[model samples]
Target: MARIFTVDEARSLMPAVLRHADDFVAVRADLAELTHDLRHEGESPLGGLAEAKGLEARMDETLSWFDDQGIEIKGVAPLLVDFPALMEGVAVRLCWLEGETALGWYHRADLGFPGRRPLP
Candidate 1:
C-alpha cells in the first residue's frame, strides 16, 4: 500500500529524502552521459557498455531506496518527487523538485506534474 504522509511528516523526512535524491541524480546523469558518449563513438562499445552497466546498477540501487521509502519519483532530469498526502481528507501529492528549498507545491493524485498547484 502507498504511504500517506501528513505535511509535517513529509517535511521531517526531507533531509534524508534529499540526500538519497542527490545520489540518484548524480548516478542518473553519469549514465546519461555514458549513453551519449557511446552513441558518438563507433570504435569501442565494450568499454562504454561496462561503464554504463555499473552506472545503471548504481541508479537502480538509488531508485530502490526511494521505492522502499514509498516516495514517488515523478521525473529524473529535474528530480521531482511526490509524497502522498491528504488535504482536507482528499488525496493529493506533495510535490517537490530539486533546487527548491522546501516543499511548496501539490496536486491531486489524478493530475500529474502539469496540474501542480501551490501549497496553501
Candidate 2:
C-alpha cells in the first residue's frame, strides 16, 4: 500500500529525491556509456567492467533510497517519480521529473505521465 502525501509533504521530500535522482541519472549515463564502449570496442577491459558494476551498484542504492521514502520511480533516464496523494478526496499521483523546479504536476491514480495536469 502507498502512503498518501500532502502537497507540502511531497514538496518537502523533493529536495532529497532530486539529489538521489541526480546521482541515479549520472550513474545510469555512465552505465550507458560503458555498455556502448563494451559493444563497440569488442569487450571491456577489466577495469571498465569494474567501473560499470560500481555504477550499477550506485544506481541500485539510489533507487533503494527512493523506495525507502515510499516514492515510486517511474523512469530513470529522465528521473520521474510519483508520490501517492489525494486530490479532493480522490487518489492521484503527484508527479515530478528531472529539471522541474517544483512539484507542479499530477494525474489520476489510473492515469500516467501523459495524463499529467498542472497542479493548481
TM-score of each: 0.87, 0.91
Best by TM-score: 2
The best candidate in terms of lDDT? 2
User: lDDT tens string, model 2, 1-120?
Assistant: 778899999999988887887788777877897888887995664347778888889999999998888899898878899999999998899999898878999999898998999998
Count: clashes, candidate 1: 0
Superposed Cα RMSD, model 2: 1.8
Model 2 regions lying over 4 Å from their true place:
43-46
- Model 1, 35-79: lDDT tens digits are 877888743443578788998898888877877888898887888
Error (Å) of candidate 2 at residue 43 is 6.3
Total clashing pairs in model 2? 0
User: Which residue pairs show collisions in model 1?
Assistant: none
Worst 10 residues of 2 by lDDT: 42-51
lDDT of 2 at 98: 91
